[model samples]
Target chain A: MTRLRFAPIPAGLPATVPFTGPETLERRRGVPFVARLGANENGFGPSPKAVEAMARACAEAWKYGDPDNHDLREALAAHHRVAPENIMVGEGIDGLLGVLVRLTVAQGDVVVTSDGAYPTFNFHVAGFGGLLHKVPYRDDAEDPQALTAAARDVGARLVYLANPDNPMGSWHSGALIEAALDELSADSLLVLDEAYAEFAPDDAIPQIDPEDDRVIRFRTFSKAYGLAGARIGYAIGPAKLIAGFDRIRNHFGVNRTAQIGALAALQDNDWLEQTRRNVGAARERISAIAQDNGLTALPSATNFVTIDCGANGDFARKVLAGLSDLGIFARMPGTAPMDRCIRISCGPEAEMAAFAEALPIALAKAREV
Target chain B: MTRLRFAPIPAGLPATVPFTGPETLERRRGVPFVARLGANENGFGPSPKAVEAMARACAEAWKYGDPDNHDLREALAAHHRVAPENIMVGEGIDGLLGVLVRLTVAQGDVVVTSDGAYPTFNFHVAGFGGLLHKVPYRDDAEDPQALTAAARDVGARLVYLANPDNPMGSWHSGALIEAALDELSADSLLVLDEAYAEFAPDDAIPQIDPEDDRVIRFRTFSKAYGLAGARIGYAIGPAKLIAGFDRIRNHFGVNRTAQIGALAALQDNDWLEQTRRNVGAARERISAIAQDNGLTALPSATNFVTIDCGANGDFARKVLAGLSDLGIFARMPGTAPMDRCIRISCGPEAEMAAFAEALPIALAKAREV
Candidate 1:
């Protein structure tokens, strides 16, 4: 029998999930997690208005979503004070990253990202046959300077930096990012991922011009907007650069309900402000819980708190395993010394209470191990 | 200011929408179409149960969807009597097609399809640098033999055939497709798009083993199931070929509500059967409407009817324009001989009555033109 042939890039790729989903773990263990504090998902949930909008949209589920994403993009543009042409809505930040990588990285192209940063970005780069150059994080923050240097040295096509970074929950100021942009190679594109920007301090986001051709920024409704399951996000960049996405993006990838829900979510500023306060309070509580367990929690500007186990990667892994065993779903960084920390997402008071209750036992188990 | 460099393939491709959405036209005209009968969407709407499921899922929208799509894939596998490994769910059939093309079609790779067949498929192939070979329709139906012959001659990597073809709404017997498989080159993969299979006769869909490596079949909830706005679809193929998708698919691309909505839609077979009956009745009514205008309505195995305008492509364009002026959204094939007809989708009695009232005026306008 003749065998089907896949392109060399995909054929050689290891079948891997960039991040293990909480649901997958539950299915494997045959039990639901007690506190779903992993995956950095917003647990306070979408604005009540967004939920109502989704319910309303469900009635019109027969019509395919507007392929142009006109209304959503227009609304986003108004919110951002940018031209609609500067925004391209997509399935989510992950989906946008995939398309961005496909649009820039050809076989044997070079890409730069901090070591153990967003693994999904690496997955996309590798899927398109781009060679990745890893720059070690500088003091647990995504070292934008090192990333820029690596891009310049390798003549990389793309460089990735996540502000208010994931796993570590550390952030860089807007001034630092603007300075890093000056150092970014003209030929290279800086993929500034601001998925967690909504949770970050205002100064953490650089006031870059929407038409900055050298940089593309991704923001998502999945994060602070609390619509991760809706799979809605957008890239803000120069008109010419943004137009490149139209050449290859799944135009109608954003669902109708997602569009409606996100629009409603954007309109509900009071709910967003309330969720931000909730996340801030939750983060403090998580830090306090970590301190109680004799762990040092990293200062976080995002929704999640990354707690240092005050031990090695192995010890941290043990603690994470113990937490899993205790039915609390939390995650850790992929590489050291970041791997010495376990990340926990903010959630409702009950979930936080569950985490608070489980932490001590998980720590004791890790210590015994 | 420094400019960023894009991959040659995307940079060279034109920024064009493969199809102009109805919303775009509405925006352009500054008014919504009175009867949306253009995009082949099920105007009868999704099963009420699916809408309820979506509304329910909206409450839990903060959680990211299961990246593996485990439950839905498992359910779909059971529904198809295939193993879960043989199935891959995606944002939509359009999304799946984009990925499948990316997986197999490298730059300059040859792909064969019927002329004026699914422009989005051609758009994807071109976006990925695949050379497209178009075979003219044989008697308004996609000529499977011609497609196979073209694939063989071009050493194509992929061949696309939409059974119960779109735009023209023509179809072939399942035995014919099975026989045409013999004519297909051993090395080429057949992309069997059965988006309308739910509306087709039994003989129109061949009973191929799910493990068949030479072919991959795509089905969607967008048609008779009436969940197009949910943006969910799946591809069935051999496990090996299906696994290739894992290397590049946006793991959590399928929205949580979409997964819930589609699953609920699938379980409501009564709604589907009723939808089929409604579509059949609508098709007959459309044919009568065409007869009233002294035009010929092509027999359709799908939810839409393609009516020959009883004149040339120019005349059909005028008729379509007149319909648009009369606030009825309709579309026609983009390429030659096929463009001589206009396509209208199935809708409720009110929409059908609107079409009936408007057809004669549109025809008169076309005659005057």
Candidate 2:
């Protein structure tokens, strides 16, 4: 029998997990976390309208959803004031990113991203055999200028930047991103990930010409809209580029319930505002706690806050372990100085109270370590 | 701005839509299908437990689903009586195929499948730049011997076959498949898709050795289980191949609602049995309707029946259009011989009566054409 051999490209990559899901840890430890902040999930929960829509759709679960995603795409287009052809709703931003990479990238094509940017994007680039050139983060935020420069240097076809980014919960303002756009070579496409955009300040979102084929923007209902479990997100770009998704994407990838839930979530802007307020208050409380423990909290735009322990990455790791031992699940960045900050998602009072109860002990334990 | 260059591989394929969904046609025609017998969807709906679970889980949709899919995988592992390490769940069979092809097929690699097999799988193979080698169906059923010989001759990395197949609604029994397996090389992975396994006769399903790495089997909730909209499907194989998914799969691809929905669907065997009964009745009625219309119905082990229109592909296309005109949506195979048959899904009285009403008109229309 001939032995199966993986392609040379796939063989080059190590059998490494893209991200460790919190559920895996819970199963291994035989205990669920009392407060789950590790994955940057919005513990605030989805809107009542979204919930109602999903619950109501339950009875008709047998029917396959409209693969064209007419309702959701139409709603999204209206929301963004763009034509329906310029929008493509997918399983999630992650799923959409995979497809976008597939369309443009071929073997050994150059792609640029922040050094510790969203690992999933890197995973997709590598999955398609793209050669990734990473620029280092500046002050825990993605340096858009550097990303653009790297793209030019590598003659990269795509450049990715997650505004109000994950892991560190830091953001680059809309103006900064818009300014950086001019630096990108026309051949180097810009992918502005606005997954956390709904939580950003009003001025933090960049205004791009929807017809501009050189740049594409990604948004999600995962954070402020609170429908991550529904697996719904979308990308906005030039009609031609957006339509390219039809060539290879799983047309029926986004579930019907998810589409309904996300549309309802988007319609209830009041709920989004409330979640933002609640998340802001929680972030403040988290910052105060960090300050009390002699640490510094990074300025944040997303639902999660990253706290600097005023020490090395190892010390922050100890503190994170201490919090985990106390049943508060939080995470930290993977690379360099940014790793010194521990990330905590904003949830309700119960999670806030859990953090308050655990932090002092974690700080003390970290001192002992 | 410089125009984005699509990869050479994608350029080879047309901007073709493999499935023209009922919704698209409805919107284009400005009316809905009174009976949707097309696409082979299980019209019986999902289990009561699954609906209730999803309903109850509505609010918790804020949280991202566990990327590792711990709970569902554990449940699936226990159900299959295999180690959890052997199971890997993705968005659906479509997503899994995308990942599998990425792993095995580099540019110009050979892939083998039936001429009129699942178009989506062929789409994925083409998307990944694999050179597809097609073997035509023999006797209205998947020709296992031809597939086996072709895989070995072509040194194909993958060969796809759906037992109780799609479009033509045909099947080769479990013993025949097992016999065919003995002739395959290790390099050629037999992709045994059991998406409609639950609907198949008990004797039609072969007992598989999960430890045998030569084959990867896929199971889904989209058919008899009635959770197609949930976008959850799993593959079972050797741990080594299972672990390979970790290298590139979007970790959080499967949503929480999907996991919950599928889990609840799997737990309720009563609902599955009920759906099977209903589906069986529907299939018989559809077959009877075909015979009444002067057509010969092919044998089926699925939740759909393929009716021979007793003429050429053109006649079948006219019949299909006639059904569409009558607001009864149905489809037919694309290739020759098979295209002579019009396909109708198993559904309740409402849809079946519509088919019955529309069949005579469609036949007359075909004669006129």
Candidate 3:
């Protein structure tokens, strides 16, 4: 056998996937998913204007995108009431997280996050050889205080917190995040992921100064803007931190169509308001379905709802499997207490109807199992 | 000021750009270029089918792309007559090179490449803290033998060689590469970048077993396929080496429109054939333009022609500046010998005519300078 040399860090790391996409599952099951509600994606899709912009951008696909991402950053800055110097656009939040981890975390460096928080972030931390210090979620919500305390205790260089957190779909106010920032170690940068901030309540996102070097907030076009497939996101932070991204980022990584699509999407606030209303209705329907099936749905500020199966992790896993078997795609958290609930994403009426029809059968099957 | 902590590697690296994109130049000059012939992008654009496919994919933009890239990978595998396991898709060759460097190169590890060959490759190596050992180009083409010698001497973990070399538009036969492989150190992995392979001579690409653990081949949709803005590229290597990407890659990184567009682009062989012919004609016109200006155009196997300005590197630099002032975007290399030549990418007739009209005026300006 030829000796192939992979660096010690990657060689020791296990080949793992953070989340299996719906397409993979469909291929494995030899059937198309009746309702694609597993991944937290907007089913109403992007605005007609954004779609038209992307379609138009396709003809100009031969030209490389602007490496500086000036227009997109300027537009994003205007939307956020921040200067362009405070923003950096990248492939997506997932891609940006990887770059951020690469920028801050070194081998064996300490990093902190909620135990069952976004696994992709954890995957990035591990990929960079960061020693992860995980704190347990508090009552389904990621405890900002606990995360900050852990970061300080561990002398972590970075701490990750996702407002309107994934898996459990719970959120804390911006003031809570600011308080957590105060508690963080002086040297520890708080990575505040607000990927779902658009769908979140107004108060859920606190007004933090972009000049604060202690915190960098992430937002994506994938959620309320409804351009998940475009793979575009941006980070807002101190000018110095944003400049540092230039030293290591794939400068032309953002797709040109994505930039154009996102720009047009940002301009279409009417479409955004309509989608938010639609998602609110869909979330309520999902909650009703859970209630009818004798389960309790956690109050959500994002596009997904996590329902307590009124049992252990095993029962919840069975419920998820039952949903999968009935052609309804759903997901559960990766860790303990959180695994007691199954998560469902909001979609259009047809998809919600499919999930509603399967929920009772799935619950019955889970009880039998 | 708040204390910000970045990793030791990034902190030590300089914030330098690999290429100053045309958009950046346009913004700086306060005028758009009449002919955008820099950056080596295919100006003839992607196939209409690809454009149609991308436009169609916009409606389905709600869904995240398959994390596995299953369909695209299968299509690429079939095209290459290799198993899907042998391929790994990424944002672009530039993005993949960064990941590849992260996977194989630790701090202070030795990496070999031709000096002034591809600045982006060097940028990736420097970003990852790899110690680069650069061998100068021989006769405007990458000297594979010298690269292998340097790798053996330095005990390099990786060796990078671009087959149809960039900037100079020169190439080496596949047999020469095969011979170089024999001389490479047993433990060193060769990264053969074939970004411009489609436009090269028939003998320039050698047949190699997909299971060859000693080599990894990179191909991009950016050049001949004209999807640079889409940022899709794939690497073919042994299954083990390819699996290593899973340990650290942004799994859902590739955009959905890119996947759809590239698949359609790959299927349109007639479009590719027409493009190849167009590129050939454009190269000839570029050569004629150079000859008309009392310059020697280098024999090119790629989509661009490098014209010797009949003086030194300074003269060529002045010519490039003159072109820039005349609203014609063109590029020259960074190092000696290669720096004496200005590189111009092949484009449509209108762009070629614009360059043709501006070449003499630019040459006269350079002479006055």
* Global lDDT of each candidate: 0.92, 0.87, 0.91
Steric clash pairs (candidate 3):
A174-A206
Q: What is candidate 2's lDDT per residue for B155-250, written digit by digit as tens?
A: 888888889888877887889889888988767888888888888898898878887877889988888888888888999988878887888787
Candidate 1: where is the Cα deviation over 4 Å?
none
lDDT of 3 by residue, A89-128 (tens): 9989999999999998889998999999999999999999
TM-score of chain A of each: 0.99, 0.97, 0.98
Interface DockQ of each model: 0.74, 0.72, 0.75
lDDT of 3 by residue, B1-369 (tens): 245657899999997878878888999999999999998899999999999999889989888998888888999999999999999999999999998998988899999998888999999999999999999999898999999999999999999999899988889899999889889888899999999999998899978999987899999999999999999999999998899999999999999999999999999999999999999999999999999888899999888999998888899899999899988899998999789999999999999999998889989988986
RMSD per candidate (Å) reads 1.1, 1.5, 1.1
How does residue B287 of candidate 1 score in lDDT?
Answer: 98
lDDT of 1: 0.92
* True C-alpha contacts between chains kept, each model in order: 0.82, 0.80, 0.81
Tens-digit lDDT track of model 1 for A244-348: 898999887889999999999999999999999999999999999999888899999999999999989999899889899889999999898899999999998
Where is model 2 more than 4 Å wrong at Cα? Answer: A1-3, B1-3
Pairs of residues at least 3 apart in sequence or in different chains that clash in candidate 1: none
Candidate whose DockQ is highest: 3
Question: Candidate 2, residues A1-369: lDDT per residue as tens digits?
Answer: 343467778778878867777777777778989999877788888999999999998767677778999998899999999999999999889999999998988788899998877888998899888999989998788888889988988899999989878877788778888888889887889988999998889899888889987799999888888888888899999998898889989887888888888888989989988998999999999998888877889888988889988888899899999998888998888888888889999989899889989999998999996
